[model samples]
Target: MVDADQTFVIVGGGLAGAKAAETLRAEGFSGRVILICDERDHPYERPPLSKGYLLGKEERDSVFVHEPAWYAQNDVELHLGQTVDRIDRTAKTVRFGDDGTLVHYDKLLLATGAEPRRLDIPGTDLAGVHHLRRLAHAERLKGVLGALGRDNGHIVIAGAGWIGLEVAAAARTYGAEVTVIGTRPTPLHSVLGPELGNVFGELHREHGVRFSFGTRLTEIVGQDGMVLAVRTDDGEEHPAHAVLAAIGAAPRTGLAEASGLEIADRAYGGGIVVDERLRTSDPDIHAAGDVASFPFALFGTRIRVDHWANALNSGPAAARAMLGKEVTYDRVPYFFTDQYDLGMEYSGWAPPGSYDEVVIRGDAGKREFIAFWVKEGRVLAGMNVNVWDVTEPIQNLIRSAAPVDLEALADPHVPLESLVA
Candidate 1:
């Protein structure tokens, strides 16, 4: 029931929102479009904020997905420095926090992404305790490094996720003293299994970075309103001038919940529920990117993946659904993380506790290898650490769902292509 010239309102100007705007225009839908973003800057790359941006290797404009001129040229109206206070579902309107401007939309897209989780302990609000999610956060952290010379600067990262490790690597590049603490037994254990995780643990240890595993941070000790120490669960404390909480992020869905939408328990983690075609409970609304937990047809389950690949692919899927085209947003989930000059790629979908066998095909000790997760003789997922080219064959195997020879996969002499059939 939408008018030909109706407006399309996209919430959250991250990758999903910005790309969705571009895709809509490419699809020949020249309707009025508006993008809402709270951040002062336009859409930029988030991954580099944890790596190159922190290391001062890339400029601010380099991180942007597209320049402002691109938006103007495409006739996309951008509402930067604007916050969407509420969503009026009955009226199909979005209210802005400043001046309370209400925008009416014939169709809506929820692309509000995630924010870095914060710690609730005392002294967490201190000046030196930070979370690296936005450009402002990266700029502030980089400034902290600039003031304190790399040799004596101490960084305490509270979580063992990708952000924590990526930042640790960047800090180490500058010869800073880095200490990574995690609640788990091994760093990267949640994603990579125990065996491979032990290798990652050893690799970090080889560098001068101290890894504190199986410990919980109790409090942040500060002096003159700035962080000075990080206290642990075991009554141990470490000197720290800077502290970062890179513990995972949760979906930002306050707007959808306030609009009387059906939210799930995993909503905070996986995000709003949608079908294979990415349609929400209300057919008039569609969601994509990190904010939508659409069913995974390949795994026959629901999973929320926060990665560049997922962000790129999900927008097209949602756009197809918006065009009333029948489509399924099901594909093997993929992601990667960069740490200490290492390029790690993870692909395909794996069920919980589903892998009965894992084949390692290279020297894991040298930081170059590929591990295959196989369940019931079927290749489910593959991970490569510094072994970039092998991923192509593994991806083919996943798509074909072919049976693998365990012995062949474990042989370093045999090429990965041998198992492609």
Candidate 2:
């Protein structure tokens, strides 16, 4: 039974951490709930950092998980700008980094999230170099893009993953010249494979975004502590006013590591290892969001996804489990992207080389289609581009794991639900 004496402390106040606190209260927990964040801003969603907020399509307040007043209204103890340096599993307490303040917990949830992978090359400390993993970063980039647009400046991006392409689209929208550098041959090559990856590459190119595929940034040449240009591995120099390191993000696992939490393999997201119920090595401590790598029953492997949907659903799942409810977080991996006129949703996992082939159900040339990654006559994953209301059937097909007729799968006339049946 929960009581006024009981306390639940949540670390890392991103969408996952904020949602977990909300879920705890919704599930009728009257205990003291403390939500802590390293960032000064209130808990906010990450997608808008690259898509809407940076594009000037969304306002500053639109990205928060809850209004500044919601925490007070809900009686949730909100702690911002405080970093939890050490988690003492034995003492059941977390110590603050700045002031060394201690907070005890009956149960603790770590939703530490992820940090953008930094470019290892020199001049990263230059004034114009930026990373987009936080609200402050996006806010800075938004202003930089506006200034670049006004000054007719060029921005060189150091990766062609989702963040790179999304930032490219936003930069182009602001009339700034964008040059994208990637080690892979196509944009999003690791996620969508070559064929569909080509589509995104072409999309950016059509919007006047330059691609330096198969190459990566080697150095950020700067002057007076400001960026001047970037040099690539191929001995080509591209002049730039700003540089964005969109390589990807790594899970923030330092606190977990220091606390001696079991960590997963580096190749598989390198996050804190958690069981099916989101319980860590210590039963009193649980994990969620990008930091927790839990066993995925559907894939029969442990996968840690850094998508917004994972943070959206996993937080509540961990909260429910913390409240002594049975929870199996087997939600199908889901992610979406909106670039220019194209909006796409991808479900299930189909890493590179894992699928036999990718089949497209509609006209890819028309910028509309459903791409399925098939493995041994079974649909391993599906991506619907500019399609509507098909997420349910697509997720159902993935869970079914039944052999499907490849021909019927590619036919636009065939109903996806029928194939699942």
RMSD of each: 2.3, 1.2
Give lDDT for model 1: 0.81
Please provide, for model 1 over 1-421, each residue's C-alpha lDDT reduced to its tens digit, 9 standing for 90 to 100: 2234778888888888888888888877778878888899998778888888888998878988788899888888898989998988889899999999999987888888887788878889888888988889999988876555445779899988788888888777777788999998888777776766777677677778898989989999998898989999989999899998989888887888888776656732558887888778888788888878777655556777777777788876777677777878876778888777788899986633767877887887778888888887778889888887776788888877778888888887888787787
lDDT of 2 by residue, 1-421 (tens): 3366999999999989999999999999999999999899999999999999999999999999998999988889999999999998889999999999999999999999999898998889999999999999999999999999888999999999999999999999999999999999889999999979999988999999998989988899999999999999999999999999999889999999999989999988789999999999989999999999989877778899999999999999999999999999888999999999999999999999889999999999998999999899888899999988999999999999988999999999999999995
In Å, residue 275's CA in model 2 sits off its true spot by 1.3
Span of ten consecutive residues with least summed lDDT in model 1 = 261-270
Candidate 2 TM-score, C-alpha based: 0.98
Measured against the true structure, the TM-scores of the candidates, in listed sequence, are 0.94, 0.98
Instruction: Show where candidate 2 strays beyond 4 Å.
Output: none
lDDT agreement of model 2 with the native? 0.93
Reference-based lDDT, each prediction: 0.81, 0.93
Which ranges of candidate 1 are over 4 A from the true structure? 1-4, 412-421
Best by lDDT: 2
